[model samples]
Target: MEWLDERKMDRGKKPGKLLGNKNSKNHMDLQDIIRESALPFLPAKSLRRFTGVCREWKLQISTPFFAHNQSYSFRDVSGFFCQSPSGALSFVSLNQMAYGVPDPSLKFLPEPVDIRCSSNGLLCCQGRTGYRAYYICNPVTQKWKKLPETTANHGTDPAVVLVFEPSLLNFVAEYKLVVSFASDLDGYEFEIYSSIDGSWRISAEISFGKMKLLPRTGVHVNGVVYWSSSMGRIFSFDLSCERSTIINNIGSSSLGAVNGKLHTACLLGSKLSVSELSNAYTNTMQMNSSAKQWQVKHAVTLNFSVPDLYPRSYDKETVLFLGGDVVVIRHEKKLISYNMKTKEFTEVITEEDTYSRMVPYVNSLVEI
Candidate 1:
């Protein structure tokens, strides 16, 4: 392979040398093994460059099967797409060497968009102008699909969440968008848009009592979508059964998924507490009984002092649990991450203005 020849030249070796005769079956078998084992593990950018080595490499890398495998194997929180209060978007790389996007501001899209939610590598954005249309896009591949307008009215500030899970058994990149909006009757209503059907449908289940679902607080775990409410309650909707239920209150906190389980992170005084919802899926399906309680997972006190870190009003403070160990805290204009395992605190970035939204992103090749 030409990629191998480049590596050989870097090591001061002859470029044209081969392990054996070019037509040997054993040589081809070794090459196939290497491609199968290593190609999926590489970052999407490297794999894109490797496609130019030869037609065989291009064919192998472009397959949907390869993209599915690569999506699962290379899935990690690369960084966040942060949007300032003035609607300016920027990308902050957690590790610049390992991960980044070609266009952080998402200029490749048709119009300026406000990112509503992100799952896996796909981002669900709504057009800033012109009827406020919705769009699903993959930043890595620069591929996008605009969805047909929903029958239900998703208000100016909608409670939208995107759900996309990559599976080994399924190669198709399928996802769903769940929007909670005001209902004509008494309480809120849910309207879901599935990529499989390419249409929006109003769920039979409706009304989460009088609690108002908070915008931009939806988190998907397993097949269920959860949203925090202003009344300190949790509203859950199961995509499989199209049922909605209310989980027990856990006060005002941020929700995230870690190791396929639902977790909540809240700042109390000088300490940051992380808790997991044990038996989340099972409890979410059963609407009658009370959902499982949150078990304390990690409670790290903020030893270092920062101005107004634990302010009396927590409306601007946000906590996000990234991966399994790091807890990201956004206080005012400072973005800090605390490692649960290492017990270390690192300042990720300091923004010029306060950010209104920070969506964690993963670099993926999933086609829309």
Candidate 2:
């Protein structure tokens, strides 16, 4: 170590002899103190200020040790509830459910938005109704991954609605952030997003008119992400292929296509099937049917007659039925959950105070 300045290190007249030479221990102590004081899990806000301290601190903050979202969950239906301008987002964790880790992708979200998933232990959130705001955040480690700044597409209403494609037999783990946006530009084009190479890029875009009944409720089947569009069309984003394919109209209007298609997702046997615009949600449309269209199966009538579920209200034409153990929904007034196994529908639960009063309105519930 370099010798201390002679004058400053004068030991003989010491008011406490020359202070021992600065060492790595002292350096590390300061880092430890700062980390312990400020919450590192939430980096969206604290990041700028934290890194502003110094270069060494910046490098240290970049490490995984300081960034993560804490796994704060609700034990039951009332365990934890998220609030959106529209309504609540609630989940009933099965006894078998396991929360791995809560990782923060961003320090602070621009505003309070929706929490799509904390899957694989990472919290994926987006802006509230009508705006395009989203970030990949881990609450535990507090490291925030990035995406191109998100904004709402004019035609599409709510900004970012996405899901993760978990690992399967032939595939590895990958997360997809799906956002519905209608560019104000020509074609008044409506497209969906798939976060590619750390950026939101257009996966599929189509000409969707005023009828905005498409269900952004995408479900992961095998390695594909299937979602319903505004006009009752079902589209699938295949990770393996990196392309979105229109899975022939299952039904014309279950989700919101005034033509009678519906919006919603359901799990059927091995294949993830959605309810058609027809009366029988269990039925699957016969692709390329000349006259006879969809045929109803007896597999599941999951949400056959339920309207007010999750975000809160759906009309006969604006809802999609899911035939599964549990069918979660967004209604016009609140968030509700239906248990097919139990044949029951839950009461209205609000995530935040705002959405509880806003009321979720369904444009169409035609089984698409």
lDDT of 1: 0.79
Model 1 has a clash total of 0
Which numbered prediction scores highest in TM-score against the true structure?
1
TM-score of each: 0.80, 0.43
lDDT, model 2? 0.40
* Model 1 TM-score, 2 decimals: 0.80
- The Cα local distance difference test for each model comes to 0.79, 0.40
Error of 2 at 273 (Å): 12
Candidate 2 per-residue C-alpha lDDT over 210-256 given as tens digits, one digit per residue, 9 for 90 to 100: 54433334444445455555555565555566554454455432221
Please give the distance, in angstroms, between residue 325's alpha carbon in candidate 1 and its true position after superposition: 3.9
Model 2 vs. true fold: TM: 0.43
Among these predictions, the greatest lDDT belongs to 1
